[model samples]
Target: MEMALCNIKNPNELWSLESCDELEQYGITISVCTDIFSTTILWMEADNNDGDPSVFLNHFLDTVTRIGGCPQRLMVTPSRENEHIATTQTFLRRNHTDCYAGEDSVMGGVSLRSHMWIHTCTPWKICFADLRELGHFTGKDLDKNLIQFCFLHIIQDHLEEFVGRFNKNISDHNILRSQDDGPAEDKLQAVLPEDIEVCRRRCTPRGRYPCDETLFEYWELIRTENGWEVPVDRFTALKLYLHLRNVMETCIDEEEQVTCIDEEEQETCIDEEEQETCIDEEEQETCIDEEEQETCIDEEEQETCIDEEEQETCIDEEEQETCIDEEEQETCIDEEEQETCIDEEEQETCIDEEEQETCIDEEEQETCIDEEEQETCSDEEEQVTGLLQ
Candidate 1:
């Protein structure tokens, strides 16, 4: 996944192509320490290596193939790093390398999408195909997580190229609610200022990037068209707001249930009737959340129990040491009484050892749990509380 995102230079001149072909057999470690240098990383490493583009492309292809992902489908999203790669990538490729990158539609692609998305950051109509073929993927849990992460990626990509693919294939994206105008940019742009304002206002906090109640509210407001052939350009504002409100309520409810500290508790301040519109979805979400909270609580309890047990062990060790000290004191007294002439040096030596051992035990106890650690922990808790407040 890391390799997929990092841009590389020339896609040729990989050292292993001929060797892998020329020799049918290869060693175990040879395959393990595969040296397909990141084109991005190598570009920074001007200290060594040849300027071969062929080797670079081969390395790129090798990485993509290893990941079981298609090279053609791989495209760099709009980013400053990519802009750097755009002008300088070809130059860095050695003679043996060849960069098999796609056409440079990055800049324009990003700008248009950003403009169109300014109003509706997420568009659900694009997921029409995914909605149509939703039943094919049996693992609903995996699908749910994947869809969420994919939507996160889709929005984060900023480039419009993936929009087509997302509209066609990304299932479970029925959750995104985007508003697209008509064929004529002018026609689409003609949406009533009031209506567009309604949609844009529906997504507050500017970017609507926060994953709090605001996000839930935005997602919940997205509603399906009433008819078989859904309208593409318009949105059911009321329905969308209702969805957003539901999301906000659900987030609040789940957030409250798993609350470990009062500071982490999320407030469910949204009004009742407004949140009731999507009760079923919100309720189901609560059930899932409760189960997750139960698991988290159990894990936390286990850790707490382990810490308590460790403290108990420390306490027991201290008690045993104290008992040993009492026994030694008795022994020293018996020797002193029995041999009225017991050496003063011997008695002092024994007393000094006992005092040293007692001091050492006290130091160990201090190290285990003391005023310093408690003060630090208390200070951290106070700081966290202040932040939350």
Candidate 2:
């Protein structure tokens, strides 16, 4: 039920699957069915030790596919060189039909970028915030740069196009390494393309680099000189935690919550529901054999009792729902009233401002008329006094 991760040092370390049957039957157990898909993923570093892993990868894919396993994500370590990365990218695009190019999907690739400040870092390039914070590369794992690159890239490649090319030089390299006194399986190294294509067409113009700084810091510590010394604390289920938190916030306020659906899981659920209906029919037939074909009084009485209980429960639920609905309506009315009150207050304020301006203008006009009348009367009096003299 859980996605198992082997927490060990070194990308060259041989990773194997344990449960084949149960995993393959996942579609049967899950109710949904249309979302299953296969992503032909290649994992391992080009520079991690001197071992060939092509045979192992081919075997892994074949085994998994045979048992009904479909890969949604193709997680891999960083490509050996820029050209190798480009060749791989191009190959995946031309050959791998489902190369993810969206910025918001979970089923695409996870690539490792070489540097932070470089522009040649593919438009879909996964860059690091600070090299010191990369916690997953430790001791021998430090040299396992490609593996670290893959993890970071996965987080970063939310929707970036990768450039890939074929390399002709490292073609004859052995796929497996030789341990002391024993020969072990080697890593898979591919022949990358010589020419690369920049994949800008599949990207968004405003897409930004990986943004979670805290996660980067924790991962950087995964590669310690003392060998990935991360604490083994109980980790919370990210979904349950996030969902509960979002619900509480939503209850008190209003905001959109983020969600995702695994296509495989959805398909499995649909399959399960169909299977359940078939099982229910078989169980009903078995019951008929034991109870006879007649509509017995006991069966009718039991059905009536169950129906009554359901009806009562429904009534109670309806009552509670009605109360809640009324409360929501009241809240809506209160909001509308508040908005209306504010509009009225704004209109009254404007009217008062206009009245103040009009009053000031009228007072100025009356004072001007009085001054003119006084000047005219004074001038007439002066002319009469001069004629009498």
Candidate 3:
């Protein structure tokens, strides 16, 4: 961007001043003031065009005086006495008697500002479009103050950029008029702001007049109230942007918390299902072991019952054989008793027969004793021997 200088060599010299035609587009009105001597853009303003005209004119004069001494004369477009610009001119003439102000056509029926507009208006249309695209300002009912608040710095930057480009190149009108003056490049003149002498050096007024207060204070005031209204200035618009940013951050935090809760619940359900599966498997194994034990006990009981039945049968057969042998021994003792009784009866009968014969022989021997005593003694001896034999 070109460095700005108030190129006033003589503070008392008469200077001519004029402005380009007002360009209004996209709910903004722009006006530019050019110094006739150096063809420099001394002041430019972008606004809603509804402000008090007196306020605007005062700021313009103050800005001019700050950069250099106020111009000696000022020329404006033709207007009726009742219109805004004409009223402002009347007001200036009434209050400030030092400046000689009149219409541009006053100089020999030729407008001084008509030729300057041809060069100035071309770049302005392009700048306005660029501003719209960059700011995203669409539709007819646009929020003019919000756009200004957001993009005011960008507007100033673009103005500086245009100043740099415009100062380096020669205008087409000047090129045509200087055709006889050799090459067009040689005719180009660089008007640097540093080279110009002025009464003082101050900040540029192109984008500085809109807002002057600190924006942080404005935002704090609105946040403390926790409420909003349609913004009437740049300060209020900035506060609205900050409030909306806080709300968006809170919503994002809540969404993350809800997602975490859902993940935890899903994991809990999976754990419960696995525990139930483990229990079922243990019960099934217990049932199988019980069945195997019952089958073994049944086999042992059957073997014990078969051994008891065989033992009882063997004891009954041995008892029957012992009773038969006892009965046969009693019958043999009875037969020996019967044979001894028959032998005792036969001995008693033989002894009784011998006793009867001895009695008869004693009676006969007494009768015969008188006759033959001697022969009887000898015969008795022989008979006794024969009888004994």
| Best-to-worst ranking by lDDT | 3, 1, 2
Worst-scoring 10-residue span by lDDT in model 3: 184-193
Residue 306 in candidate 1, Cα distance off native in Å? 2.7
Per-prediction TM-score to the true structure, in the order listed: 0.16, 0.20, 0.32
Deviating ranges (above 4 Å) for candidate 3? 1-23, 49-52, 79-142, 164-389
Across 1-389, the per-residue lDDT of candidate 3 in tens digits comes to 01112433222222233333333444444445554434555555555444434434544555444664344434344432113333333333333433343332122112455555446545544644654675534434333443444434444445556666664453544455456544422211122233222211221323443433344345336556775654443344445544544543465478777777877777777777777777877787777778777876776677667667666666665666556555555555555555555555555555554554555455455545544686788899999999999
In model 1, what is the error at residue 60, expressed in angstroms?
53
Which digits, one per residue and each the tens of the lDDT, describe model 1 over residues 277-350?
A: 46967898899899899989999999999999999998999898888898988998888776765666678888
The weakest ten consecutive residues by lDDT in model 1 span 22-31
- Number of the candidate with higher TM-score, 1 or 3: 3
Tens-place lDDT digits, model 2, residues 13-130: 2222111111111110000011111111122211111222332233333333343332222233332222222233334334333333221112222222222113332321222212
- Please name the candidate that would achieve the greatest lDDT relative to the true structure: 3
Per-prediction count of colliding residue pairs?
41, 51, 0
lDDT of each: 0.37, 0.35, 0.46
